[model samples]
Target: MGRAHVSTHQSVGGRYRLVEITRRETNSVRWYADDLRTGRPCLVTRIGLPEEPDGAAHRAPARVLRTTESVARLCPGRIATVVDALDEDGSLWTVTAWIDGTPLGEVLAEQGTLNYVRAARIALELLDVLDAAHAEGITHGELSPGQVFVREGGPVVVTGYGLAGSTTAPRLTAPSYAAPEQARDERAGPAADLWALGALLYTMLEGRPPFRDRGRPEATLKGVDRLPLRTPVRAGPLARVVQGLLRKDPRERLTRQVVREVLTRVLSEDSGAVAEAVPSPRLRGGPALALRCADRRWSGRTTVLGTTLAVVTVTVAVLAATQSLPGTGSAADAPAASASAPGDRGASRPPAAPAPSPSGTADLPPGYRTYRAPEGFSLALPAGWQRLDTSRGADLAYRVTFGAEGDPRTLAVTYSTGVGSDAVAVWRDDVEPRLERSGDYERIGSIRSTTYQGREAADMEWYAEAGGSRVRTFGRGFLLGGGRGFSLRWTTPDAAWEDGASREALRTFLRTFRPAAG
Candidate 1:
């Protein structure tokens, strides 16, 4: 969680002092608290229990505490490990280690729409944890955005694993995120969690939940049971997967295996190719196309045709300004005017604006100068930074990394001839899968598709644990033409991602990068 902006001096259990309110869902609130006894930070959740007879109220806290312990033992670091659970003054309080991440609901609220590929990645991670639970006959009855926390280093931690059956009330929190079975007052099993997963994916891709909260729990659940789903305009390649999981009938919904396959497919195929064919819900007066997953396979051939225009855009152009500007571009900062020319895309075009001068003597930002590579690339680099590593593929793909000896930041440039037709797909399918296999890999958000230097491009950001520190990376890959492309990757420690030095480096890299002459 980010730093608390507000504090409440209220104390619970007399030993736990509430420092901040992290989140509030229906009938519950989560807080960051200081364990006055141990002088440590912890997360505490408080839920109001309904009046119960037959000692049900007495057993609720024990059930939650026991289930959380068992599940945490089974899933390890994936789920929050409960340290304590107590019944206090008509409320159930479950406390765990203080997690350094943001709630998934907060992320969605701030970012609005996410990349379908990114959403799929998060869903896959959640599914893995859920799979472990279901195999052990444990169901995450209340799996909603607020129950998931995303750490800066890429892994997500889940909470509220054992709350499903603790209460006789159908759904205890976030009624808008409730499953159809729960809304129907049916016994929710793993299928209910699947539905909640689908609802979460929908919320992540669309700014709002599929069912609106009517300020009352019954009304929200009624909407979930009766309302027709509003078609997702930006889901792109995830339409069918979302719809399949959201089936009104539990038995008819897609199984977990099938859902996984569809989400995995979206990362590998071009979303636009299948999106144009699916019929979307008619809104107001007209119909729109729902961007559903393509049932068919991607042919080895690329789908997008290259333009005759000579403009060559680099994929890294956007990341240079990703943090500084949201959906906007910087002033004239083309990279072809200096030491290189655009590659063999079969066009003769005018030269781009000149690259930044290598002599720290130019009008460049302080502490930075251009580096003209013998391989035909040039970019402004920070002082003292040098080539750190290089690797190559059998198919003429190569990557070169640059960084200072002691600095925790690095930039990598890659060039390849066997590029796929879709830049976004290349990152989501090809590149990301490889990264996932690497140690502690976690993608931050969706792979974004945007224009770079007047050409098609894609950008992906993620995090990995390295040497006890969380490292965040941003990558951009763009095609030249005919299965040829270039990519640039930048990495920094998560804590320093927003620091001025890192921010300036990104902007300078984007502003001064000169592509190699073909």
Candidate 2:
């Protein structure tokens, strides 16, 4: 959902230097990256979360890490182990041990319809992982061909395990595979995963989804919700089982036990249908390890649908989901959905005193100084404030946040290279949709068209809950011409908004900010 534009050859978090664009989807991208600290290769994914108004962002990374670790322990070799989950700029960057396999989607592209026996074997393995998760009351929420990786020798590894329910987006990456319930924006449950399992199986055997992706996630989801599934011609013995899983009603979808039985029966009965297991191709004479499809050619068939929301909206949602910024609501109660979008970054720099302003810092508030960023922006900050986090998107949009430990307030500055010309329209068309989807978002007033430092701008204020406390945020965004724009977001606890210091801080930031020279 963040800008669909990350450049290759940049380092993420100053550690994972992206070397190649492995794969791209509607809202996410895969990278072949090198871990600078350990000299190891890793697979990193960037996913745009729903924009919330409160503490959702602060809690997201921990949730992702905890869920991933728990599931990895439950299903050892079958799950991709997460190395780190970070909230950067406005995206979640999840790093995992490099996987040595081709994405199932890529495999499908290379070898269209898979043999039923092979598909069954893969399904059983997937079910094994799902069974372990379901037994612990965890639902995958998002299961699609893109999330599954197949080794040349047939071992399947699943990624994006802890991503369900991470954001408010109904189905982040693959809308065609979303269950009828998810497509309708209802709470997703284990049944949703079953539907996706059926969809994946259908795709494996039919060379396409039961409901094709019709360019827009909402449209595709509508099809999943309302359209009768096409009859499977190549599913063979798997047809009935696949159909059972894809039932429109969640209560009617086949249960895991029944699915397991059907898949096991197929494997047992059609012994000759599976290709004989072969040795995995070796990488440097060791186990053949490849980042998920890093070596494969980019496929035009698999981009994020064009009807997806704008990048600014995605970044706003991610910032809300990851930063726990005031006015962004919590995602604690949202059900897991799917993982299917974009890039991530989380690098922190030590606190440093702001550089002396050419215009003189003598007039600044007590204990405040000017901090000049290497990113070409500058602003006044409280004495102890420093760069706390930074994030980047595929479209080259980035956000930098500044704060001090023990301080609940945060100032985020976001720059986007792909923005519309009108500031009010940007907020209404690009931003408001995302905020409305966030929990407990209440706008204080109409979006006000204004001017800042001689540039046309718009301001919006809203309130939401963050960690059991009501919080508020005021944001101002302006155009810099040539499709470029920057936003200043300041968040504070609702109770503290009236504090003299907080009021002064907001004024200082707004009065002193200078965008990097173009």
Q: lDDT per model, in order?
A: 0.64, 0.64
Candidate 2 positional error at 460, Å: 29
Residue ranges of candidate 2 with Cα displaced over 4 Å: 1-7, 270-518
Model 2 clashing-pair count: 36
Which portions of model 1 show Cα errors greater than 4 Å? Answer: 1-5, 269-518
What overall lDDT, based on C-alpha atoms, would model 1 receive against the true structure?
0.64
Error of 1 at 429 (Å): 44
TM-score of each: 0.53, 0.52
lDDT score, residue 371, model 2?
A: 80
Worst 10 residues of 1 by lDDT: 323-332
lDDT of 2 by residue, 1-518 (tens): 12212334556687888654454444555666788899999988876666788757556778888988888878767788888888875777888889988788766654656767667767877877777787788889878876898875435788877677777778877788889998888998888988889999998888778997664578888999999999988776677778878888887766676676667566556323312221112211123222121122222222112112121111101111010011111111011001111011111111223333455354798898888878677878988999888866555666677889999998777765534334554454334544666567777766666666666666666677778888777777666654456677777888777687886787677667777777
Per-residue lDDT tens digits for candidate 1, residues 159-223, read: 99767878777888888888888988889998888889888888877766788776568898999
